[model samples]
Target: MTEITTAQPRSLTTALDIPRPPDLSWYVQARQPVGYEVNLTRGLLNPDNPALARSVGADGYTSVRTLVVVDKVVDGLYGKALRAYFDAWRVDARWKVMPGDEDTKNLEQAVEVTAAMTEMGILRRTEKVVVVGGGVLMDVVGLAASLYRRGAPYVRVPTTLVGQVDAGVGVKTGVNHGTHKNRLGTYFAPEITLIDPEFLRTVEPRHIANGLAEIIKMALIKDASLFRLLEETVAGIDGDALADCGPAMGEVVSRAIAGMLDELEPNLWEWVLERSVDYGHTFSPSLELRADPPLLHGEAVAVDMAVCVALAVGRGLLSQADAERALGLMVAARLPIAHPVFTPELLEVGLADAVKHRDGLQRLPLTNGIGDCVFVNDVTGDELRRALEFVHAYAGTRDGVRDGS
Candidate 1:
């Protein structure tokens, strides 16, 4: 008579390990710690600033070689200044200018940027790519830098209001693909990001409004004080006011940046699909790409946020008065609360796509109240239809002015 016993497996040593037979499987694990700075400065291209020059780890005595990928519009405005700054710092910079609009965010544009890097003989590790433009340009060049030699260092100098406050501060690089916004993208951190509010002076009023929408998203989902500040100062806030960097705008920028960083730092790779920062993003991607005139990124987001607010109210997660105030703030900021393109069919399609993107659940972020958020996975088609109808009626009360009017 023989008694048989099974052997116990040894304990796993790594986070990614499976407790399988060593002879049958192998496992390895590694963690990459990403650290980067988002610096707020004025006149970044001024030769005397030294902020941009120092970011590349350059001293005054030695000449550094680097590639600069800039948006054509930004280049037109600051090319000479950038040239003089580099020349003064004894740095050799190769300039690659490309169009930086929503329409131009694509794989081809990213390839063009990579080609420019190759032509300039970019050093994979030692030298860095400087991206100067709005969110679109940053995404394109960031993707290019990420693809070059598998991974190359890059710096972001976001020139638009959206760039300074939202896109420029984050580590996501993406381009729209075939009618899908940010369908193709990568999570690549920049070496550093320089934000200059002074750049906003030349931005159009409409674009300024576009940027404010993102700030509002932060307010609704994270900071009640920020929402109050926006309510108080939105009447006087414009591109010029933001460029001036006065007390109100400065606080707005500071809080928005801090709030965004707070939400992002904890979950940079988004291993957790539930996110408060995704409040307005759930449906905006589809609407942004489908609009006839092409709504700006923030404009699309505003419409989505409005609908989500209405959804929250219907669910009793937010007060009716709070919903009105939130929608009112969007109008005051000159952002769109409703659009013709955001139809019931589009809502269904967007939710379907979002479910796929969020790992087989809606995970839709809705404002529970001012400065708070909740995710709902069980949102039905009827609910979305009612929300859309509510948004349209709310927009009508504003003297028949809709988005793009």
Candidate 2:
């Protein structure tokens, strides 16, 4: 008689035809971006994402503006396991939690949260903080950290897949305005990013899928081989295997994220950040902005990819067949190809806002071909409107060709 151990990590095999040897040098910073403190725990899955403080060994500096949230999730940092981390270290903390506060991926709430922390003098320079939940917590807490003391050190322990793969790695952090996602934010990097795959075992499936969407975006935009790896094995893979990306696909992704952030690191004020808009976001952020409650930043970005794919076809940037190849992959993964409830008014609003928010200085990048894309801010109102209408029709299934674009 044999028994499978319950604690064994899952595994899968799908060979990706990587064409070029990855440049290991791309990851090396001339001067380290900044020193970080990461605490990765073994066996025990804790609710708090910031494991660095515990791993820092000795009593590190207490946070001036510790943005604490009242989390009742037994699976999150707000739960009992986090108390154990504090107990292990035996450090006393002055923290407060406000109940009944709904968590939103919105900026208004972020502003309010930051103001409350500032008023309490909980946020200050020289002290570091710990943000406890998923991406929303990171976005709000990170923004608060950046604003307080004009900037303070904070560590992130991402509790969700969406947070780990995308938001958690990138230096970008922000709060949404009205319907616009991340309209208010900064390029502040964290003091450390801790990943505890144990926490992901408790994540909901839809959230995991959303995180995969961002990962796919990075793959599709940069490497065909990586996209193939995701397309072939995403579904059958267990939750922990997905989170174990530390070995599976973490390096390639880290480089891409590092590259993307480096492009903005030099221009933190966003003076040149728009130089990398890369087509998918123009409509994506607009859809997010036009959303009354604002769309999930990732969801809106998925829909934006649809709009850009169609425009790529219209502008002779991408061949119809190539566009279909990308579309098929997204559909196979069950991602939203278009916004089902999007309207003409909403589309117009989204596009106009994207254009208004940008400087006329340069055009953003759009995929013109495989492993290669282009940026030309010359996108016209007519072409952009048509792209939106196509998205509208496709998502509604009004024309049974949503993925066709």
Candidate 3:
């Protein structure tokens, strides 16, 4: 973990088990759905979608480097969006293909890729880079765009379920080290985000479940309606299920997008940054870091949320029943509460890494109840170890270990 400094939120705090609702009495959910004007249109391989070009015109972008994946099925669709958007727009546009996964986003990889693209004369100062893909593509391109000549405008066209609902749209950018996830990163906002749910048809169900975890986390933090929807609508998201078939799916997704709009408006620099919104994720990167090959980003976060909920129970912050019920829904939705094979040793390391990566929090805002949480930064190291051990054992991921001897 890089010895990063931790910043405390403007809030009250208490003992480990005492969760409290945020003081949002003065805050109201915005009227226009919490985001900027969105043109979520549908079209097939059209060369003049105009939405992209129109966004450029409105956002004042001059040069553009559109990057995407060639392997995914939706590549053709994105290619269509890009080709048409580029041809119709008067702004300078370049297309760069980025490699996938943690490796490509590494500092060296980002340095090399950006330089090569520049050598090819595809990037410039007058334009911003537009990234099109799932989370991995977004992070790599987001990081590159942030550093390219200091900074440039960028837009996101998230094509996967996880990308669409969670990681891609967020301006949190980073590359991972061997066992540490998102070890290097920055906070840069995208100029525009174009989310089209129709793209989910091409995504794998596991990946869809991965995205669902984050939505469920959002529900845990803010919306009970979303929690109920996940409980009723999610039966078997894996195998041969269209995960988004239920009305609950649409309801939750709409609410999330609305929340996104609230913070991402007029440039994403305000109070709604990813850290403030990503509750359980503060520990998730560490859990993934403990994995030999590391779990997928969403997968690790789902597991982390499970443990987080349980810890909330142990600390008197959340009810045991609530934790169980949430875990049950996650399991039914086919998300894992357990790692492939978790051990106390690995868990200790994960906890330390999680806390370290988060810069020795203030633990993530542990939920006292729906739309309620308390800031707790003074937990003993032993307590966190015990919490991790107990959850892992209960979920059959490890042997039962009490919360400290």
Candidate 4:
């Protein structure tokens, strides 16, 4: 027994291949139907109407409270009035005001918001959290709602045009982490998204143009009619014009909202890699986060879209005239079509990251014309460099005009 030497374990090549019933072959699947309304209304915060209470589910239960996380700017503008409105409806409410800007949107801010909601004792499935602000606050607080006790009901009252038309309409919520745009996030739909054009009245002019960038993206990728509408009305879209919500502006918002819904609703979880909606997003994230002044989300997207247009033109998938028209719309909207941060090296890094994100292939969506898209996996690093240079030269011409040179 002592000399057995543990049976010498086993010979190096003694065992033959023996396969058993392969661990019970199976797959798991589920379907969760998430439906939310993105309502575009005016005067949403008016105390005379009980719509806010109804929208937040405060009218459904007396014991429940609507935990309101408001952007600092929104709070300054309507905080007292909002509190009075909630009180008039005899609805219990708690308000927490936080700064809502790209720089402030982070994991700590999200955690802070979640902690405040936690202190309010909101019920997971019943009581609602109301996030009132621009895109940044919506993202930060929406992320909080998604994390608290696993998931909680929330309503979005988008106060900015960008919030109403783009960020608020989608289910994705996120905050930047370590120089990465939306590095940590989750896709959690809101119970309702209340969009009031009235809020745009107080927004700065530059912000209005920021919102138009996303709409332009939708038009270029999927809706020719939308592209035409934008071409028809781009000159009239001043900051004040958006606030007025005239017929033209209404159609723009409606069509953009509808287009976004059409693209996003079918694949809310973003299971598809060749997403038309990712046309500008592939390169914008890095440009947005790494810029010296930290360019606005849509500004970076506009620049990225310009580069993609150049890439498409180079491939002969899009005509030079069509590319100019697409880019001209961005210029007419007063959106920046290029930035110094969008150098060849930076763009290459963004494209490489996007390739990884798209599951090891470049699922780059290029325009076939102004309104159709084709996903290509064959974009080379040289093509990306040339595209960046093309956008830079084009933007120089546009900037010269703005500078009155």
Best by lDDT: 1
Per-residue error (Å), model 1, residue 352: 0.6
Global lDDT scores for all candidate models: 0.91, 0.59, 0.62, 0.86
Worst 10 residues of 4 by lDDT: 396-405
User: Which number leads on TM-score?
Assistant: 1
Arrange candidates, best lDDT first: 1, 4, 3, 2
RMSD of each: 6.4, 19.1, 14.8, 7.4
lDDT string, candidate 1, 31-105, tens digits: 999999999998888888999998886787899988988889988988999999999998888888889998999
Ranked by TM-score, the better of candidates 2 and 4 is 4
C-alpha positional error of residue 305 in candidate 1 after TM-score superposition, expressed in Å: 0.3
The segments of candidate 2 whose C-alpha lies over 4 angstroms from its true place after superposition are 1-51, 54-78, 96-126, 244-268, 277-279, 289-295, 388-405
**lDDT (tens digit, per residue) of candidate 2 on 137-244:** 777778867776677667776776667666676577877666556678877777777766667667766566566666666665665666666656666544666556
Model 1 stretches astray by more than 4 angstroms: 1-23, 399-405
Candidate 4 per-residue lDDT over residues 1-405, each given as its tens digit: 467555566644446333346643557999888988888777777766666888766553464578899998889988988888888776788889999989998999999988887788778787889999999999999899899998998999998878988999999999988978888999999989988888888888888888999999999999999999999999888767887889898888899999989999888998887899998999999888877776778888888899999999999999988988988888998888877667788888998999888899989999989889999988888998889777777777785122211
| Cα-lDDT of candidate 1 | 0.91
Evaluate candidate 3 by giving its C-alpha RMSD to the native, one decimal.
14.8
Whichever of 1 and 4 has more lDDT, that candidate is: 1
TM-score per model over all chains = 0.93, 0.73, 0.74, 0.90
